[model samples]
Target chain A: MLDSFYVAWRYLAFHKARTATLVACVTLLAALPLALQVLLEASERQLRARAEATPLLLGAKGSALDLVMNALYFADAMPAPISMAAQDQVDASALALPIPLYVRFQARGFPIVGTTLDYFDFRGLEIARGRPLAMLGEALVGAEVAARLGLTPGDGLLSSPETVFDLAGVYPLKLRVVGVLAPSRSPDDRAVFVDVKTAWVVEGLVHGHADLGRRADDSVIIEQTEGNTIASAKLAQYTEITEANIASFHFHGDPAGYPLNAVIVVAQDAKSGTLLRGRYLNGESPHQLVLPGAVIDGLLADVFRIKRVLDAVIGVVGLATLLALALVFTLSVRLRQREIHTLFRIGCSRFTIARLLGAEMAIIATASAGLCGAALTAVHASSDELVRRLFFG
Target chain B: MIRIEALEFSYPDASLKLRVKSFQIATGEKLALIGPSGSGKTTLLNLVAGILLPQRGRIQCQDVEVSSLGDRQRRDFRIRSIGFVFQDFQLIEYLHVLDNILHPYRITGALRLTPQVRERARTLAAQMGMGDKLHRPVDRLSHGEQQRVAICRALLPSPALVLADEATGNLDPCNKGLILDLLFASVADQGATLLAVTHDHDLLPRFDRVVDIAEGQSRS
Candidate 1:
């Protein structure tokens, strides 16, 4: 048998071009769907794990998909302002810890999440370089953001466009990169973190009037500076957070009257989460409470149904590839009739002839499988960037 | 000993029928079948080798009936008891010369190529003037050298019978004589029977016996 294998190998190597082309065809056909499956599975696992970690999400009335994407995945647009009254309702509930999240800005295409230090502790993020965001306008960059943007402590970054390109809107705010988070293999690796107050400041919620220069007279004469003029001008334009001025950095209303996008609520356990969900759905409550995991699971269930269909399609494609391989081998044997006859004349039995042919095919298949496996591992190693390009784009 | 009694065969698509009656050779005898093209010389050799069984009669080598054995048993019989040489010198093109010589033993699972067997192959190859061509692929050899290798392969196992189908049909005069002498010498050294099919009248006198197979009949 080993001798037959050697013979088969020699024959294949003698026809290097044909063998290589067949192996490459087989490898590509096997590798593409395998890689796609791995990526989808990895994304699903990441999303579900992140969702399960956060027990509940309290947000203004909107798409639950958007809410989960924002609070859990740090994606999509921030929800409408749930009133401070609504937040107070959830904060008063003894069953949960409300972590207010205000997201509106982007730094070099990464979402800027404004929340308290509890957000870091809850997400298990650690500062890998420099200090955490302790002051307004200070930011903690995710590991990927830091590495990609080459940002370190004290480096400054201006907020990117909130909309596609709202040039007429307020100028981008300059934020100081105060820290970089340690490498965490989660959604935190793609976000920029700051204090919720900084988010409000970035959004122009609370206005500050700095005395640019004091006049020499005892009675001070004040000229509205560029900073105040820009702030107040923006504040007067927005009657509400409409599509026109929702991304506006200036707010004309009282700063205390402003609303947050959503509040991430962590229940003590599964029982408390159920109790909170029931209370919010009682119709007496002003705002709605949702379990991030359950809502995301519902959303993913639809996606998984599509995935099953895709899997069936891939399964059919794989079977077709196998059939094509069998056809190639069968045709190859037919084409090599003279060669087979020659082998038989040289005292090779019919069984040896068949063994030689089988050994040749097995070697090619095994080699192609090995190459496909290595290619998958390389894709897995670089899946982070691939996923970001696919989902976060 | 090899014997074919009242053998009648035909190609699957042809109406031509081949008939051979009372063809026999004693053990260790070298006999050649001489005939023209379409005279059924090659077909008779194939039948005797159990590669193609006679449709109407029996081919007996030593004591085993070639047509009575099943497919697997026939394969074993061919590997253990008989060897073949073709006119085209049908050596496996991808194998080296030495591997081609050992091809018979691979099928039989018989570890026959001991030191003595290797020495015998080397000596026979040297006698046939192919000692330096052992590692060369068969396709690279000249027609005469390939025929010598085929002959060596046929005799490598020291089988009870060796059958050649126009084995030296393409060789030059000098190489042809050398090949015939080496083939008969190797069979004599092994005390094995030889049944050679040929159309060359010049080579007929060297064989122990000569039989003319025409229209499928063997006439001495």
Candidate 2:
């Protein structure tokens, strides 16, 4: 048997071109599915880990996938915004601690997340360089964002439009980079964190300007005026920080009108989570509450269904590959009929000849599988950035 | 030793049959079967090699009935006792010359070649002028060199009998002489019997016995 195997190895090695072609076909066939499986598994693991960290998500009623992508991954825009009043309502409840997230802009292609310091604490994100987002318009860059954008503390980044453009479009505000987070290997690593007020300001929900063309003394006097009413003729198009008109620059609409993208809730316990979900679904609350893990699971279930179809296709292709191999072997046997006859003439039994052929196939398949497996492992080990670039982009 | 008693065979669509009655070759003797084309010389060799079973009567190799054995047993028996060299120089083209010569041993699990057997193969190859070409692939060799490799393979395991079906049929005059000399010399070294089927009348005198197969009869 060993001798037969050696003979088979020699036969495959003798025709290096045919053997290499077959091996390459088999290797690619094997590697594609293995790589896809590994990537899907890794993405699911990361999503699940993120979901498990947050107990529940609160947002305006919309597609559950969209809500999850917005709240958990910060990858997409929130179609509707929940109110800060809703956050206050949730915070007043004994069931949960509402963490408001206001996201509506991008910085260098990474999402700008406007939330309080509790968001970082809840997600267990650590500061790698400088401090966390401390003041308005000041930001902490995620590790990936910092590395990719070459950002550091004391550097500044202009907020890109919600809908990015090919050319350098209008920049609403410049965010001062105050800190960089350590590599968390989480979604946070791809986001820029700022105060929710700053996010609202950047979204044009709030505006501030200096009163131009007024003498400095007059401007200071107008800024100190205490009335809500501003004389339309005297009010400059832009207002500055002064004791009088600074009050006029304050938010004019009802506080409820300032909407939040979403609120992440950390429940006191599992019981509170159930209660909180029940309160939101009670048909009275305008907002929708969801378990991020459950929503992500549902999304993954849909993805897995598609993966199943892909797997079926891969299975059929694999079968076809085997059939192709068989066809090649059959054609090979036919082409080598004279050689087989020669073996028989040289005192080789039919069984030995067959074993020799089988050994040749087994050797090629085993070596190809090994090579493909090694390639898959290497890809998997270095897949994080590759997958992010391919899919998240 | 080989014995054939009233052997009869025909192709599946044949309207006529080829027949052989009472043919035998003694141990250690070189016998030649000479005939015109379509005289059933190759068919007789196939029957003796157990590649085909006779439809009538029996073939006995060393007193064991060849036709009576099952397919597996017959395969083993052929591998252990009989060697064949085809006129086409049927050396497996993918194998090197040395590996082709060692093919029979690879099959029979009889890789143990005594120094004498190895020396005999090398000496026979040298006589055939193929000793320098052992490591080369058979496909790269000339038709004559391939024939010499086939002969060396046939004689590798020192089988009790070597069957050649028009072994030198495709060779040039000089190659034919070298192949015949090597064939006879190798068989003599192993003290193995030779049953060669050929159409070349000039080669007949080299054999210890000459049997002509024509019109389904052996005329000695």
Candidate 3:
């Protein structure tokens, strides 16, 4: 066998370009499916884990997929926002802990989420630096947001306006960066957090004033400050709220009508989750209660269906590559027929010829497999980033 | 130490038949085989080496019945006892000069490549003026150098018989004479028998006897 290997090594070495091309083809075929499977499995695990962590979600009667995506991933699904009254109702249920989520704004391409301190505690997010949301208009940035935006405590970010043309619908609010959360390795790390009321402020449901009628100097502020204070172009929007003016931040409209995109409910137990789902089961009700896990499972079922097709495609490609390898080896042997005959005349047996060809193939296959294994490991290691770019982006 | 009687061999799918009525060589005789292009000089050599079995004949080389051994046994006997120098000096192109010489030892267990054998191969290469070319790939060598490497390989195992089929065919006149000198000197020093096929008649006088295979006949 060793003698056969020595001869095999010589043949392959002499034909460097052919051997290299064959090995590269094998590596590509091996890595394609291995990388795909590793990334898909990692994304599935991440999605399932996030869904399982959030027990239930309450939202307007609409696409449950959209509601779950909005709540769990802050995906721009634009499911109709449920009223704050619904969130108050869940809070009053005493069956579960309610955390209101309102996400309709962006800052520097990152979603700005408006929720309460309970949101952080519920998600087990720890403040890596600075303090939590200490007051309205203050913000807590996720680790990735802080790192990517270079925002530290006391830094400020302006929300992206809903429309650059329609200044009446909502004015972009300026938020103070009060804290940065530790790495969560999830979608949460890519979001900005604030008290839900701050989101209302951005929506024109809330406002701040030294007074709308009088400027801080006690003079008529502007000529357009009569009908709607937030819509008034001359009604100076507070770009920065310091301690002196922070006390004046307050909501103008009926607070009960404020919008919440979805309410995440943490059940006291599985029984409480069942009872909550049961109470929201009235078919005529405009709200729907759902388990985030079931919703994600439905999403993954569709993904897995696509995966099956992908796997089949890979299987066919693998078979084709295997055929190509056999063809290459056959042609190689035919090309070396004269050499084979010479070996025979030199007293080498037929077994040695077979072993020579077999050893060359074994070496190429083993090396290709090793390269594929390394590629799979790299995909596994960077899968979190892949998921973010694929789904969240 | 070789004999052939009533030998009849023909290639598969060919009409030409090689029939040798009688032939014999002493244990250490240097015999030259001369013939035209279509003559069976190489065929006769192949038969003597047991590479091709005679359909109806008796070939005796030392103790082995060359015409009757099985396929595997014949191969073993060839590697252990007979060395062939092909007409084309068929050195494996992928191997270096040294490994080409050691190929028989690698391919079969009939001859163990002892350290002493390796040393002897180096000494033989040095004598053939190929000692410095041992590590060079055989394909990169000049025609004369390649022919010398082929002769070195044939003598590496110190076989009982050395068969040459136009062994010096690719060399110039000067290198041809030099190669012939090397071949004769090596065979004489090892006490090995030599049977060579040649188209060049100028060097025919060096052989102890010459066989003309015009119709597969002999004249000594």
Candidate 4:
């Protein structure tokens, strides 16, 4: 038996290309389904943990999935905007503590999250390198954003414009990066968080420009009427907020009427959360109150359903590949007929010939198994990052 | 060393048949069986090696009845007492020169491949002028060198009888003489009998006896 293996090893080693191709095919056939399962399990853990941590969500009457994805994950899809009065209503009900979110902009490729300081406490985020957000327009960058853009305390981050050609539309705001949050290993790691007022400034809802009362530059005036001076399109507006120009910035409309994307409601108790849900069930409310955990569970159900179909497809392909491998072995035996004849002429028994072929197959299978094991170990280690990038990107 | 009496055999898939009335080879004798193509020269060689069973005959090699032995017993007897050298050399392409020489030991448990056997193989390769190329693949060797390797493999077991089926037919005239000399020298050194089959008439004079295998080596 040992001599059989020795001869078999020589035969396989002599055919380098055929041996390598066989190993690669068998390894991939075994590793694909296993890697997919690892990633899906990781995705489930990631999606559910974030959702179950928050009790309820309040947003404009629309897709609860979209609202949860945006408010909790800061996803690119912006749900229909609700007014700030929704957050006020949640607060007035005395049932939950509502954290307002105005996530409607981007800085570079990362999402710019406009939220209150209460969100930091709710998510258990802490400053790692700089101070917290204390004043308007001061930005606290996430750990991943800071590392990717090489940002540190006292640096500046400019909000991205919605469009370069939106000349009369939203203006880009320059925010001061006062701190960098520690790595939370969640969606917050990839965000740039700021006070909601800074986001409104980026929206051109409230802005500050040159004072019209002092007509120091008459040439900039488009029209002057009784007791008021109208400015032209070239009026010098403050893009970066500083101590000198902070007082000049002001809001134009009622604070309750401002646009908000969603509100994360943390109820004081289970009864309060249930009552909040009951309020939205009345059918006359403009906003929808959702339990985020239930929304994620439904999403996972659909994912698992699709997973079943994928599993079936992979099974068929695997079976086909196994059949092809068997055919290859059969053809190889046929091709080696002359060699077999020589062995028989030299007095090799039938059982000995079969043992030689079996040894060759055992070596190939062992090599493929080793390669598959290494590949699975690598996928298992990186499943978390893979899920975050695949599902939430 | 070999005797056949009233042998009759035919392949199951083919209509070709072979018959031998009576034949005998003396111990330590070198005999050559000569015939045209399609004659039963190589079939007689296989019968003497116990690779094919006779339908109605008895073949005795060194007092052992090779014809009456079962399939497994014939295989065992053949490996223990007979060595074969083919015209094509039949060397496995994937193995190196030394590995090709030692292949017979690996195919059967009846041949115990020990350290002494390995050393003898190396010494035999050295004598064949292939010591420097022992690790070279057989496919990379010349026709003459490959035949030399086959001769080394057949003579390694020092069998009592060596079967050569057109061993020198594939070589050139110069290589033919040299290969026949090497084979004759090895058989003489081991005091073994040799039964070589060939169609080449020029090399018949070197054997001790010659038989024309028309219809068969032995006839009624």
Candidate 5:
């Protein structure tokens, strides 16, 4: 047996290119599916955990998937924004804690999520470096956001302009980074968080005085003027709100009607959850109460349906690879006919020849399985980052 | 010692048949089998080594019935008792010279590979002028060196009988004589009987006896 193995190993080593090609074929057939399964399961676990953690979601009646994506992923395809009065209504229910989420803006490709202070406690977000958001115009950067943008607690982030073509559009807000949150291994890891009102300010729902309350003493300008008290186009809009000018910032409309993309609701108990569901049960209701867990489960069912088809296609490919392997083995045996004859003439039995072939195949298989194991572990370890870059990029 | 009686052999798909009524070689005797290209010189060697089973014959070598043994038993018996050197020097190309010489002991449990056996292989290589090339692959060596390696392997087991099938067929006249000298020297040193099949009559006078297969050395 040892002699056969030595010969087999030497034969494989002798044919370096053929051996490598065969090993690579087997590794791909073995590892690709395993890596895919690991990534998908990790994604499923992350999606399910985030969904289960948030008990309820309130958004304008539309696609529940979009609402889930916006609330959980801070995805760019935002649904229609609903008024803050809906959040007030859910809060007035007294059966759930409603945390408002306004996600209409981004900073350096990272979503700038505007929510209340309770969001940190609700989502179990911990500030890794500095304190949480304590004032308007202050931003809390997630771990990934900080790492990718190299922004520390004392840094500042300017919101991206909604449209470069809209010259008269709302000026981008320059937010002061107050803190950096620890890694959450979720969408939050890549987002920037600020008070909801700051987001409203970014949406042009509020503004400070054009000249910031400066007026010429001799000029007769009394509240009916355009350029009488206005500053230049550059200084016409407040790029940032500080303690000195914060008082002048005022909403253009009723503050209750401020738009929010979605509201995450944590029900007090089962009965309150039922009552909350009942509140939006009517077909005529403009708002929708979504159980994020149920929505995610539905999405996963569809995802798994596609996964099953992919697995079948992979199975066929695996079978074809196996067939090709068999052909290669047969060709190897045929090519070594004279060698086999030599072995036989040297008093090696037919059993020994069979053993030699078996040893060669077993080595290939064991090495491929080992490669698959290593690849699966690597994919599993980096699955969160992989999904984030792949889906969210 | 070797004895054969009533040997009848033929290929499964050919009309040619080989018949021998009786033949014998004494212990430690050197016999040269001379025949035409298609004659039964190599076939007789194969029968004696238990590599081929005769249809109606009993071949006994070293007091064991070679014709009556099973395939597996014949293989074991052949490895333990008979050593064969082929016309083409059937050395595994991938194995180094030392490993090719030790091939017999590696294949059979009947031959245990010991430090002594390895030492003997090295000594044989040294005697055959292959000591410096022991680590070289068989395919890397010259034809003469590969033939020397074959002879080294054949003699390594110290078999009771040594069979050479046109071992010098590919060698030049000078190298051929040198290879025959090596084979005879090894057989004499080990007191092993040698049955060599060759078409060269120039070397016929060296052996103790000449068996002509075309003329029917033994006919009933």
Candidate 6:
């Protein structure tokens, strides 16, 4: 048997290109389904864990899936934003402790989650190093974000502007990284958490500029009306907030109408959760409250249906590839007929010849299996992040 | 020694028939059999080697009757007692020279490739002037060198009978004489009987005896 294997190895090694191509084909065939299974399993686990953690979501009447994805995963497509009044509504109901989330901005590809300290307590996020968000314009980054951006406590992260071509649009805010969250293995691990006021700052809703009252240059102040001074375009506005200018940053209009993508409501108990869901049921207001777990389950069902279609397509392709491989082996056998005849005439039995051929096939399959196994191991190792990227991208 | 009498053979749907009334080769004798195309010289060689079964014949190789043996027994006898050298050399192109020489040992469990057998194979290769070219692939070697490797493979088992079917038919005149010299010397050293089938009458003078075949019968 060892001799047979040696000869088989020699034959395969001699024809390196053919053997390599066959091995690559088989490895891809075997690894595709397995890698997909790993990623899907990870995505399911990730989606389910986060969804089950949050009791309910309050947002504008739209796709519940979109709301849940945006509110939970900080997905790229934002759901229709309800006012801060929605969070107020939930708070006023006395049924839940509403955790207002304004997840609408990004700082260098990481979502800037705007919420109060209650959001941190609800998500169980902890400071791994440095202090928590204590002052305005200060932000705490997730462990992954901190590591990826090479940021320490004092490092600065500039928010990515919404529209680069919009000249009057929001300027990129340079927020101070005050703290780094510990590794949570959740979407929070890659988020940039800040106060809801800072998110409004990134949206240009709130800002600070050089005080016209203290303007040393009178030429920049175009108008001086009662309790109001209209400034010219040359009046320097601060894109970054510091201790010197922090007091100047204030809202211009009613604070109740500030936009929030979704508010995560933590019910005081089961009855309170039910009461909150009932109050917002069927669009009682312009807002709708949803059971996030139910919404995620519905999304997973759709994902599984698509998975079934993908599985069927892969099955057909696998069958076709298998038939093609069979044809290749048959053709190879025919081409080697003369060699087979020579072996027989030299006193080798027909059974031995067949065994040699079988040995060759076994070697090829084993090599492909080894390569497939290695690829699956890598996918399994990185499946958590891969799932996050695929879902949240 | 090989003896054949009243031999008859034919393919199943073919009109070709091969018959050898009587033929004999003594031990250590270099006998050459000459015949025209379709005259059944190759078929006669196959019949003597027990590769083809004769319908009616007494084919004795050494102490055993080659024709009466079972299929498996004939194969064993052929591997153990007889060595074949073909016109085309028949060396596997992928195998290097030493591996081609020892390929017979690898293909069958009957022959154990012991360390001593390996040493003897090396020595045989050295005698064939292929000691330094043992690692060279058979496809890279010249035609004469390939035949030398084939002859080395044939003599590796130290068989009692060496059968050559137009062994030097593919070589140039200079290589033909050189290969013949080496083959005859190796057979003499092994004390093995040589039954070579050839169409080259020029090389017949070197054989101890020559037999001519016409149609299906032998004429010595």
- In order, candidate lDDTs are 0.77, 0.79, 0.86, 0.90, 0.87, 0.90
TM-score per model over all chains:
0.77, 0.79, 0.88, 0.91, 0.90, 0.97
Q: Residues A54-124, candidate 4, lDDT per residue (tens digit)?
A: 88999989898989899888877789999989999999989889999999898888888889999999999
Report the CA-based lDDT of candidate 2 relative to the real structure.
0.79
* Model 5 C-alpha lDDT per residue in residues A161-223, reported as the tens digit of each score: 989899888679999999999998889999999999999888888877544446444243334
Leading candidate by DockQ: 4
Worst 10 residues of 4 chain B by lDDT: B211-220
Clashing residue pairs in candidate 4 (N, C-alpha, C atoms within 3 angstroms): none
lDDT of 3 by residue, A1-393 (tens): 777788878888888999899989999988987788787888898889999999999999989988988889988877998899998998898999999999999988899899998999999999999998878788899999999999999899888887789856676778999999999988889999988988877776777655654554433343454465333354566755678787777777678888999999988989998999998899998999998899889988998899899999999988998898889889989988988888888788898878788899888888789888888788888899887677656
In terms of TM-score, the best-performing candidate is 6
Q: Give the alpha carbon lDDT tens digit for every residue of B4-35 in model 4.
A: 89999888976668888898999999999988
Order the candidates by DockQ, highest first.
Answer: 4, 6, 3, 5, 2, 1
User: TM-score of B chain for each model?
Assistant: 0.89, 0.88, 0.95, 0.95, 0.96, 0.96
Q: lDDT tens string, model 6, A1-393?
A: 988998998999999998998888899889999889988999999999999999888889989988999999988878998899888888898888988889888999999999999988998989999998888899999999999999999999999988899888889999999999999999998899999999999998888888777878889988888887788888887899899899989887888999999999999999988877787776457888898999999989999999999999999999999899889889989999989998988888999999999999999999999999999999999998788778888
Estimate, for each residue in A321-393, the C-alpha lDDT of model 1 and write its tens digit: 7898789889989988987876565446677788888899889889899999999999898786776566554
In candidate 2 chain B, what residue range of length 10 has the lowest lDDT sum? Answer: B109-118
Let me know the DockQ for model 2: 0.46
Residue-level lDDT of model 2, residues B70-121, one tens digit each, is 8777777787778788888777666788777776666666455456756767
Segments of candidate 4 deviating more than 4 angstroms? A169-171, A208-216, A223-230, B68-71, B112-116, B215-220
lDDT for position B213 in model 6: 73
Among all candidates shown, the one with the greatest lDDT: 6
In Å, residue B130's CA in model 3 sits off its true spot by 2.7
Of models 2 and 5, which has the larger lDDT?
Answer: 5
lDDT of 2 by residue, A212-289 (tens): 445354433434354543433343432122234334344547766687888998899889988888887877666788
Instruction: Estimate, for each residue in B1-220, the C-alpha lDDT of model 1 and write its tens digit.
Output: 7777888899898655788777789998888887777777777777877778778988889999998888677777777788787888877777888877876665445445467777877877787788998889888998888998888888777789988888888899988888888888888888999888888889888888888776333434
Classified by CAPRI criteria, candidate 5 counts as medium
